[model samples]
Target: MRVLWLSSIACNGNTHSFLNYPYMEQFLNDFEFIYHPVIDSNYSLKEIVTETIACDILLIEGSISDEFKRADVPVVDIITKYAKIVKKIVTVGTCATFGGIFRESDYKDTTGLHFVKEVKIDKFKDLLNKTISLSGCPVHPEVLVNTLYAIKKSVDLQLDNFLRPKDYFAYTVHNGCTRNEYFEYKVDNHKFGELEGCMFYDHGCQAPFTHGSCNKILWNEVNSKTRAGLPCMGCTEPTFPKSNLFGTKKNMGIPQDLPLGVGKRTYLTLAGITKAFTIDRLEKKLFDD
Candidate 1:
């Protein structure tokens, strides 16, 4: 299948993320890459519009803009023209799938490709069947690779309400986190770079509620931001980088955000019971030779 890739209003973070795949070159062999922003294929903005690229699949990166100019052409119009001919449409990043960080500042002028502020576009109603959304700040390479493989194999994929693949989005980042023990014990990491406590309580981590397999699959194969003592940042969620990202959300000195579906009262009660036993093992350094 010939895949056409386009980007607008982005820093090419997704492209970089995909490049991190250890076997990116081998994995890409399955499909015929006709055009991409940074990879093998090359095409200009004018060429993308005029040339009849036999595109069976279309992958879009970055947020769309009805106001901004690119190569003297409106990006939204470019997307609309291509969406008409492609058999499958994939929104590759959070910006393309759900109007990410950029939309926060210029919401009225900027929006995602298929959906406008999470609302599906009327003109694209017929194209919904072909649309696939892979949302993440800089989308996971595995997700993109797996999705492409599935498409190449003609396998039927399941998707959630937002059109995200069910397999990847079914589990939250908390499902297999290293700090699960700490979370169970209600132990909170007061500062960054600690390996002994859960980050949900006081470190601004959103692994429990947000969907994605950051913990299970792991980032860079060995560590994630959380494992290194940094917060999850809730990059997978539509409302990422929630206010005061540097600080935790608290209610009366306690964490405001609970695990995915755990009730506040239940969580607090469980927290109280767990905090009673502060294991020395978790408090000590993770690595000691």
Candidate 2:
């Protein structure tokens, strides 16, 4: 399969992240990249801009705008031209999937291939059948590779409401988190870089509700943010890059956001019960000097 990667109103973080994929040799053997931002491929970007490149998969890596142009050519024209011909269209980050952080500012007209922060872009409605969203600050490379293989084999992928493949998005970042035990007991981390408590109660952690397999799959196939004593930033959601990211927003003493499918009342009841008794092990540092 031939893949063409394009960027618009982006920082090219996704392209850099994909470069870190451990199995690049294996990935390259299965698919051919017609044009990539950094990697030397079959076609140079200049050539791709002027000519119609035969692409099996069109990978868009950033938020787009009618005004955003590449090599003096409108990005919309390039994307739309291929959207009609490609077998699959993968929007490869929160930016391309939901108009992400770029849309938060003056770029009001910037949008994803199919959405603008939850609002559907009617212009691309016709391409929804073939478009797949892989949302993250920088999407996990494995998920992208797996999705590509699935597409190659004609495997039916179940998608969520956001049009993300359910195989990866079905679980929250908390599913396999190292801090899950602390989360279950409502033990809160008061500071950064600690292994004893859940950062969700005090420090901002959207893992319980944010969809993606960060903890399950692990970043770089070894460690995740929570594993390294940091909070999950919830970069995959449409409302990502929320203000005051390090602090949890609360109503009275209760968190404004609860875990996915979890009710506020049930959470309060559980909080009350869990806080009443403290587990001795969780109060101490995992590695004491």
Q: Choose the strongest candidate by TM-score.
A: 2
What are the TM-scores, per candidate, against the unseen true structure? 0.91, 0.96
lDDT of 2: 0.89
List model 2 lDDT by residue over 165-222, tens digit each. 9999999999999878888988775467566778888888889999999999999889
In model 1, the Cα lDDT at residue 175 comes to 80
**Model 1, global lDDT:** 0.78
Model 2, residue pairs in steric clash:
none
Kindly give the stretch of ten consecutive residues in candidate 2 with the minimal lDDT sum. 187-196
Once fitted onto the true fold, the runs of candidate 2 whose alpha carbons sit more than 4 angstroms away are 105-108
- Model 1 lDDT per residue over 1-289, tens place: 7888778777799989988888876877767777777776756657776666667788888887777555677776777777888878888888888778776655355667666545766655677888888988899988888888888787789988778898899888888787788877776755565567777877688888888888778876888777776778877766765787756788898778878888988988997887788777767676845
